[model samples]
Target: MTSPSQILLVFPVGECGGAESVFMAIARHLDRSRFEPAAWFLRTGPLVEEVRTLGVNVFLHPITRLSDPVNFWRTVKAGRRLIIDAHIRLVLSSLGYGHLYGGIAAHQAGVDAVWWQHGIASPMNLIDQLAVSIPAKMIITSSRVAARAHVEVFGMNGIRLEVIHPGVEIAPDHPDRVASRQVVLDELGIQPGKVVIAAISRLQPGKGQDIFIRSASSALRRYPQVMFLLVGSEMFGMDRGYELRLKRLAVDLGIEDKIVFTGFRRDVPRLLEAIDIFVHPATAPESFGLSVVEAMAAGKPVIVTDVGGPRETVIDGQTGLIVQPNNEQQLSEAIETLLANAQLREQLGRSARDYAGAHFSQRTMIEKVEAALHSVLEADTATKAQRHEEGR
Candidate 1:
């Protein structure tokens, strides 16, 4: 039997976000016999703990700033040490900055790199493009839009790009959906049987929580029992002031009591179970709508902005509804329609869960990722052999 291929996965973010979660999921589920995975983060955070809990080897590297000369050298030194110590043949980078630093470090330490593009945006700098080009055997992206963006902006060849959509675990039916709803409602002191319209996302401007709040206010005038739930935290250095502004807006709209803010929840699946409708009104482009999928997995009818991966995930009028980005009227109308029709909501929710189960399971994601890694390694070896033969 062949020995396991050792890989060093590098992440640039300090906190656990969507990208960090995706890395953790892969590290947790990757085949141990075929691949030995290790993680290196720029700074220690909650994700470090999460990675370690999954039995993956985790290391911390102090990165003050990418632009600082002293920090850059330190980063290089750390990268070289980790690559050598871990016996890593491949370095997997999650974002652009991670790819840039990790690629240089892996090359210095003599290992191939694979840049995993999680965002819709392409690399902005020439060095970043070259770093990915020279050292990386392949590039893995999550969305077709991202792949197209890479080719259009950077002239990236199609051969180098591989699209792998992230997957989520479907939660089992909660035995205590009513009790769980009561627990959350009791904590918020909300009345029983209130219509809960929840936007379960990180409290950031790009997430369009402000628009959600405005829409909720409009919806509440027609249905006062409707309680708006904003269930997430501003952990990713996204505008903290946006959360404050949302609260102030709720107060100004005279619907502060109707709006509930639950910060940094650990029980998202359970929270999704409690929510009646899941609404995602992101103004910025989401490469993939993991939260929307998660909500669907939990058997909630979802409504998302008609952009990016949401369009791919949510089938309008079939699985869920898609509204124009930043259009509060459209968002409000969708929520009202779902709320008014229990039969339609049940039909869409069942369809959404079925679609999510078939398409976005964790097993599918792990298998696809394994295939991509093997393809890259095999191609790299063949190319090297060809070069050596040509030289001889």
Candidate 2:
């Protein structure tokens, strides 16, 4: 058997967010015969255990601030040691601290590094910019729009930015929609026979769950059978206090009984099966739309804001509908349209399942990642060979 190359995945946080899940999926699907993956984390969270389940070594070196020299240097030094001792050939980093330490450590160990960009137009600090300039070999973004944003940030004269759409798991067999709907509705105290429309995302300011509530209220008046499920968790409940604001708005709108808040969930596929329509009303541009694609994978007709990554994922009319963001009237109309017409919903939902399965399978994502890594390694080798020839 050929020896596997060790790749170090340095994650900044342990949160089970979109970017983190993509990286974990990469690790899980990476060809073990040719590549071995391990991970290093800045702090621990629910995802740490999940990453460990991939049979990869994971280390946590937490730091509160960029200026924390003790932890920062200690972690960097540790990264160097890890690179050397574990024979790490490449490192992939996400987030601020991960880029800082992972880039520095890769340079220290004389290995290749790739930066994974997740946030949309979220500017990097001077220090992170410097780290990318010096040590990072490439950047991986989930969408072409995101790639363009990073290129502008990086001042792209010759920067290599690869747009790799994160993959989703296509369920082998569709979940039992009737049973799932019954269970989820019963648990959330949503009376049976009510139409379920859900926004499955983190409860953050940019996510626009508050906006969703406004539209849902409008839709509720038009179609009283509609109930909204807000399925997500607040990161320490700190979305500019948006969740509380949403509750207040719901009560004021007199649609409090029509809403259910299920904080953070593991049964995403089941939840997707349960919901009749998937709505993502992001007020801000998203770097990528994982949930939107995942919903499509679940064979659910989706509605997304006509901005950012969803533009790339959903074919507007073929798979799902796209409405202008923050427009309550438009959002409500889209919701009502889907709820009113079962034929349209079924047509879109079936196309969505086929599209997701063909385009976003987990194996395809893994292969793309592996190819990108190999390209960098091969380029490095060619450069070294050229340098040696010149010296001779």
Candidate 3:
């Protein structure tokens, strides 16, 4: 029997974020029979262990300060050696640093390098852009918006760009959803008949949690039964006093009683089920809204900023309402509209679920990734044959 192709997946951070989550999914769901998967991470954390549980090998290589000439050449030499020693037939990098360090190693080792750019957060510095121009087999973008950014800004070919929208899974029980809602509400001391409005993302400035709170303050004046949920925490527990800032704002707004901050809960699926409405009001352009899709999968009506990948995910009048990004008044009005019309909410919720299931499923993402791998492999084979013919 032929051995499976060993593929090295390089992602610097071994932590859960939007990009990391998608990388984890790819490692977990890759066609195991044909591909042997392993990962390289800079540091170990929750995400590293999670990948290990998926039966993928994880290696730690602290790649530091590549801008300095000595560090750059030393790391590149080490990366090249690592790829060769591991017998890595295909090399894939997620995020900026990984693309620079990992792609360098793969290029020198005579292997095809694939780059996955999930969002704008992984800004391409001089080193990163140098790596991109240097010879990549494929550049996988997570959204259409990202694909355009790469082409217009970085001058990449559309033919080489592969866009795979992010995906999430839905829990399969309605009764359990009701029970979960009750459990969460009880824990929060929220009374029955309170409408839950949740903004589910890391407590960061760009995520627009502050925007949500400001909108919720206005929303509370009109709808007193509303309860706002802020459902995430910053990485490394380094919130940069953002949480304190939010609390202070909440107190000043006089809607402190209406808000609930559940910092980093493992029960996201349960919370999504319990939440009445999902709001993703990103102050900046969101590459793709994973939380928004997860909420839609839970059969909740969503209101997302109309500026980025989130806009593409939702059909404004059908799946969810699209309001301008960073506009508190527009956001509040959208939320209030959902609150007042039960029939509209239900209709949008159902449509959102159907759209999410069909368009953004784990299976759909896995299949697209599988196809990309085969394309790269086939292209490599054809290129080698062409070289042999030219020599003759």
Candidate 4:
């Protein structure tokens, strides 16, 4: 029997952000009988240890800055050596640094490369230009909106772009709903019977936590029993003082007592169980809205902005409600509508749970990703054979 092909996965960050979580899911669930996966982290953090616990080989080579000439080439050399030594058949990378460095290493090592595109494509930077110029076999995006954004910005050139929505693990029962809600209420010193509404994302300006707070203020006027949660922490100093600003905004809106900021949670699934309603109000176009799908997997009715990937996942009044981005009144109205109608909430939650289970389960995502990877390898092999035949 032929041995499983060795595939090297590259990540620019070793922190468990949404993109890193997607990478970990891939590593944890990939089919070992068909492919053996290893990882190289460009920056070392908690995620390196998390991946190690999964029993996948993890290599940490801290890259200070990719812009530095010496730093760039040295890391490329190290990556090339690792790929060659591991007999890597294909390189799959995440984020920009991963694409640029991993693509170079795979090119040098005579292997095909693919990258996960985790952001909405914007104006091309120098790094973006360089990364896009690499001869990667595929560029995998998590949503059709994201894929279209890339085409609008870069025009794809000749690269193959595949849309693979992010997924969550679906459970047979919501066993923790009551227990998790009690735990959160006790932890936050809130009394019982209050409805929990939450927005889960890092405290970034683009994440629109302030908008959530503003809407929460409006919702509180109608439903005094509603409690709001902002769950997640800032990362990489990108949103310095952003959390403080959000807190101040909540205070200014006179809803500080009604909101809880659970910074940097590791227990998102449990939190989702505690949540009665989930909200994602990103000011910018989100790439995939992993948290929105996660809430759906938890059987929670969600309210998301009609800006990006979340709009595509929800059927607007069927699966969940979709509101205009940054519109505090619309968001508040949606929240009030759900809170007023328990039957509607239950119906939407059931539909969302069914939709998420059928289309966005981890098993489904892994199957799609595995097929795409195999197709890339097959196409590369066919191209090589054609080149050899022509040369002969």
Candidate 5:
């Protein structure tokens, strides 16, 4: 058997967020017989140490500011050297900034680059243009919405663009929902008989915590037995004190005590088991609704915004409800609809669990990613052979 090809995974930040989770999954679960993966983190944080435990050589080359041209080129050179020294055959980068850093290095070292777009479907800016300038072996997006938008923006023939949903683990055996719910409720001092609705994401402006709070306020006005849980804390210094703003908003709406802000809990699946409903109220479009999928996997019915990945993943009146982005009235109605009807909640949750298991399992994601990597190398070999034949 041939030796495993060395692959370098590049990331913009080494934090445990949605994108970082996908990065970790790949590093941990990739077939060791075929590929040996290493990681290069642009900024240091918690995940760097965790990645080291996976037996992957982790390199920290911090890029504190994106605008610093000197630092940018310096890290690119460092990464290129690593790529060359390690004999990296392929470089996989997360998001656009990572593409800029890793893509350029891969090009310098004469290897294939594959970029995973983990954000919304939006018009490409100058930086985005530069990031995509380095032709990739394949561009994998988290959702079809993202892939189509990127295919148009990158002006590709859609041959190299692929849609691979980021995966979440679906435990075959779940903790008793009643017990889990009581544990969370008891810990938080939330009384029994209250239906819990949760919105989980990093505490950032466009993530729509304010919107969720307002909807919760409206829903709670009619239904007194419902409690709102806003899970997650400010991550990567991106908060801009948005968490405080959300809290103040909750207070202003007179629903402060009705809501619980469970900032940054690692027990998301357990928390999902504790909640009756899930909401993803992103004001900006999401490339893939990872939390939404996680909730579904945990057998919780979700209410997600209509303009992005969540809309694609959730079926209205089937798996879950899809409200218009930033629409408080619609969101409030959806929340109240589920709160008022336990049968609908259970029905939607069952369907969502089935759909999530079929589509977004960790095994499915790793297998798809593995196949994509193989295809990239295969295409590269084929191209080299074709060139050799032409020369002959």
Candidate 6:
């Protein structure tokens, strides 16, 4: 099948978050001969460099703030110029003001637009709704629940909504497992044969890092060799209070030395390789649990909170365990269970890896994204032709 000539993606953040990860995966794995992909980010950060390293053209839009009227219009003009100069046929946006700006700019440039929903934040304003709903040919959501939320909360039923699950690449084997385990263990001053329970996510209250630490405190008594590895940095602009709080909680519980904070490590796939078990105890709804998927892809058993997207990804007790969100006791119990039964862990891990490989490969994600883009572009063309006929 033929691919669109050129596609432009606009996103609000510059960091390597879940949506950005999916966007980069799609950009890297998409059929390059058919589709020329470019990206525009509001500010420069890790994602910009990552995308560029993948040989995708990236532009820095440099919007000071969403409320800055002059900068906002300037961004619109810049986006229009990008669309025209690049011969962009489609504009895909992730979320926030970027969606509104990208949709408006695409309309101004006479290009098809799609707003890719990545989260369920606040409702869109009237202007944003019109910019996103009227100018955009379709709305692409990462999950079915997110699509339904778009329709129910924002009243954007006029726009077509398509769900495309994000994908992850499974390593041929846990290639970095040995090296990463040695490095992590050495850095933590821990020895071999210690059970590692790893959870990687941005340090935030909603992410439940504190809950994990507190739960680990109790769980460590039974399994003193168990090391709790917290992998990730604090969220952008958020205070370091959460990180400090977790540390304090661990010290107060007398499990401080057993807990290790590896701040924002780039080798997450490798880190997942080294860990014995993975847990995601997010207190809030996760639109899609990319970290959990990554862990599963690494052939590790997972225990995620039974909320939002994890419910779709994790099959409780079969693939991995799913405990109630914010229940530290239950979380600890699940972790201990996986640690105690090596055979059960191996079985679940194998199932997880197989399930992730079958359902969440990068190729699968790119195909779904390409199909959505094709559908949106074709629908736009048909709508234009109908309008022309009616005018005649």
Tens digit per residue, CA lDDT, model 3, 1-392: 87788888887776677778788888988888888889887656788888988988888766555557777677678778878998988888886667887887888999988988776533445655666666688988878987787777777554488898878875465656677788978988888778899998888888888989999999888898889999988875556899889999999999888899998877788788778899998987777888889889888999999767897799999999999988999999999999999899889999999999999998898899888987897798799999999999
Clashing pairs in 5: none
In model 1, the number of clashes is: 0
Q: Please write out the lDDT profile of model 5 over residues 205-283, one tens digit for every residue.
A: 7888898998888888789778889999998888578899999998898898999999998889878878899999998
CA RMSD of each candidate after superposition: 2.1, 2.0, 2.3, 1.5, 1.6, 2.5
- Whole-model lDDT per candidate: 0.84, 0.85, 0.84, 0.89, 0.89, 0.83
Task: Spell out the clash pairs found in candidate 4.
Answer: none
For model 3, the local distance difference test gives 0.84
Error of 1 at 125 (Å): 8.1
Clashes of each: 0, 0, 0, 0, 0, 0
Give the residue spans of candidate 3 off by over 4 A: 64-75, 121-131, 157-159, 236-239, 389-392
Residue 37 local lDDT, model 6 = 92
List, residue by residue over 196-279, the lDDT tens digit for candidate 6: 898898998888888899889879888888888999888656766778888889889999889899988877876776788999
* Worst window of 10 by summed lDDT in candidate 5: 120-129
Report how far residue 45 has shifted in candidate 2, in Å.
0.9
Instruction: Give one digit per residue, the lDDT tens place, for model 1 in 1-392.
Output: 99999988898876867777788888998899999999988877778888888888888886876669898778878888989988988889888778877888888987788888787764555545655554677888787877777677666654478888889998777577899888977777778888778888788888999999889888887787888889888885657687888899999999898888998887887778778899999998788878898888888899999769888888999999999999999999999898899899889999999999998887888899899888877877788899999999
Work out the TM-score per prediction.
Answer: 0.94, 0.94, 0.93, 0.96, 0.96, 0.92
Worst 10 contiguous positions by lDDT, candidate 2:
121-130
Give Cα distance to truth, residue 9, candidate 5, Å.
Answer: 0.6
Ranking by TM-score: 4, 5, 2, 1, 3, 6
lDDT of 2 at 332: 91
Alpha carbon lDDT of residue 161, candidate 3? 84
